[model samples]
Target: MIEPTAEPAVEARGLTKRFGSKLAVGGLDLRIEKGTVFGFIGPNGAGKSTTIRMLMGLLPMNGGDATVMGIDVRQRPEAVRRCVGYVPEQHLIYRWMRVKEVLWFCRQLHEAWNESLARELCQQFELSGQTKVRHLSKGMLAKLALIIALAPEPELLILDEPMAGLDPIIREEFLETVLQSFCRGGRTIFFSTHMLGDIQRLADSVGIIHDGRLLVHGSVADLLSRTKRVRLALERDELPAELPQGVIRTWRNRRECVLTITDCDSQKVQHLEDAAQVRVVEVLDVGLEDIFKDYIKGQREAI
Candidate 1:
């Protein structure tokens, strides 16, 4: 297990962005500790990419400040880029360049480029250095992009939907390679994706964003432990006038209702049972995916 440090690899304060009249990201504050695998999760067009771009200093923020590897992103973007490896959502490489040529070109840019690591990664991914970038398949392109990012031996890696579109087998293989090669070193990884399963598998901490706002951020264990699904078999056909305090969403039938709640415990359950006079059928632990869904659903309802 990778233990995080006191110093943050990435930190943002009241980060905001707007495109003319449209708000892309708004008042977002985030912190990612060193050596921690932090997953940035949200639905498509929920400002995940926008936030990442701002952090990478690729896009200018309209409000707030941020730092990457303790280098002020706004003032020293190039310095931040030097220390951070980023794989964008789109694989934007020269299509005409051969694999080896691409590697050589990137090697010239980064002072910390590791040739042996690059070669090893290429071999592991079954990439032929002779092949042109245009001829590579989608999975191969993804692999090549990752190889480029990893070859720099960066302190922090920021991946924006790196596994967006791939077969399950290929995705699993890619994730395994990432775990073996990158994560074992205790380097910080900040990746954004809508895939909950990937987040669950890769992240020690997760931040959920919706419609340009963060819903919650915490460790995976804390999230799973705090959020629960309470199944109740109601004594009568009707629900109580007021639901439980932490209830985010509720599903009901004639005789039963399931409450999706946060910060749930025995006391809260007992209180609900006493107030509503409903029998507690079960208090089940919720999965990460379900928890994410419930948060998203609750946010949508609020909007």
Candidate 2:
């Protein structure tokens, strides 16, 4: 059975990493609850990979602590590795190893390896035992990597941009495998990706990172319920210095103003309308991608 607990699947406190003059990750503190599919979204070079590498113990943390499956990752990386499966953005396996030889080597490392599942996954991914790792296409290599990770039946799975370069069809195939196998087993999945649609389809929770910091983190449903895009048609051309409550950002042209706001509900919108003496033209629902873009737009535009 999947063995998550009250202690959380993953936790990091004040985790920091630096490269000489540059700070790659800056004091990130976050948690992933048991049995969750948590999506990590960030802009390019936002330190997503650095953070994941630190968590997996592949790289050292410049400061702070991280734990996976209740074990200190920095101190007990083997313990953490035993319980977690990782799919990186690119293939990292030895190219000279034959497909089955690689599988055999991986199988010997973990006590929990399941041969039946491995066999089944090979079939699902259309991989053959005779093919060398170098011969496998990118999509097939991804499948191979995923199968190796899953065969150990890890309680937590970490995927860092696992779909990065795959064409749409291959991406769909990989996503389907994750949904059917990992999600079905109650394993906690923490994956970082630029593909917001993947998060929309698979994540129970979402966290957005920008400039080495988490801008927002929460349950996807709750976040969606709390934020909105609003348009107001006002009698006055000039907006009041003190704008309506809940506004995050606002844009105005003549008699109309568009606002992005949080904690937005029917009551809040009604109150804004009544207080401002303006007509509420539209209250639009937005998906995760819109929210992600909105959060980063200001940070980028500032420069």
Candidate 3:
């Protein structure tokens, strides 16, 4: 077993997973530093869940290697689990148990469980001890899961689409909770979600995956700064089959060509417009989601 490192909270090298003939995650690699909030963003069936499961050791990988909290995931799965807190997309507690009963069960299993922190998170998450798991609303169930994940005070938090089915209000609350915890100190967060808005809200760094492959991965600031959505007004009734370098996606509609590009700025936009013989009508700043969408669109059209 590898000793826990003070630097990398999570690391993967050529991590691979498969189910039957389908490659769910393929040759995936990522490095999440300690105390960083790393968001994994992708559409459904993009291998995000499969990758998270691999990290949690809930599903075995077919190839490659991974580590969490510096413990080799495949070699010492139990040690890796000890230092990671996991929140899955769906509720998993027994329906018959009361909220507090589940907590008691978890506390018994984890010798390192901090009771004070557990109590604190229970209050913050507004979970009631007396309420049966069966009677909890979807939002309440989500909150309960968060409290359980937090109570352990694990060094790394692994969340798998925890906010997937939540309403905007609840999602906002969840984001707030995550942000508060992140600001507290020295904890690493690795989460996968289709909710790009949540990624923008909670992540310092992000990785984008699609069809068992990584599309982009880097600091959120760097990604947003490099990507842009540009709108061009075509003076001539012609559409070029190819656009200038860095244009990830371009499509003509009526008299305009809308495009998204990476490694672009104002000067580059001007140059592109001149080269393409189009007027630069608008150049818009984009978030992580827009960049991901543009890439996916480009990939689809290419195929």
Point to the candidate with the largest TM-score.
1
TM-score of each: 0.93, 0.91, 0.89
Candidate 1 regions off by >4 Å?
Answer: 1-4, 235-238, 277-281
Clashing pairs for predicted structure model 2, backbone only: none
| TM accuracy, model 1 | 0.93
Candidate 2: which stretches are off by over 4 Å? 1-5, 234-237, 244-246, 274-281
CA lDDT for candidate 3: 0.83
Where does candidate 3 stray beyond 4 Å? 1-6, 233-243, 265-282
Task: For residues 1-303, write the lDDT of model 3, one tens digit per residue.
Answer: 123356598889999998999999999989888878899988788998889888888889999999888788998888887778899877798899998999999888786888898787778777889999999999889888887888778888888888878898888888888778777888889988887777777788899888899888888888898898888887776654456578878777877888888788777676765655675568889877678888888878878
lDDT of 2 by residue, 88-139 (tens): 8777998999999999999999989999999999998889999999988888
**135, model 2: CA deviation in Å?**
1.7
Q: Which ten residues in a row have the lowest lDDT in candidate 2?
A: 238-247
Error of 3 at 200 (Å): 1.8
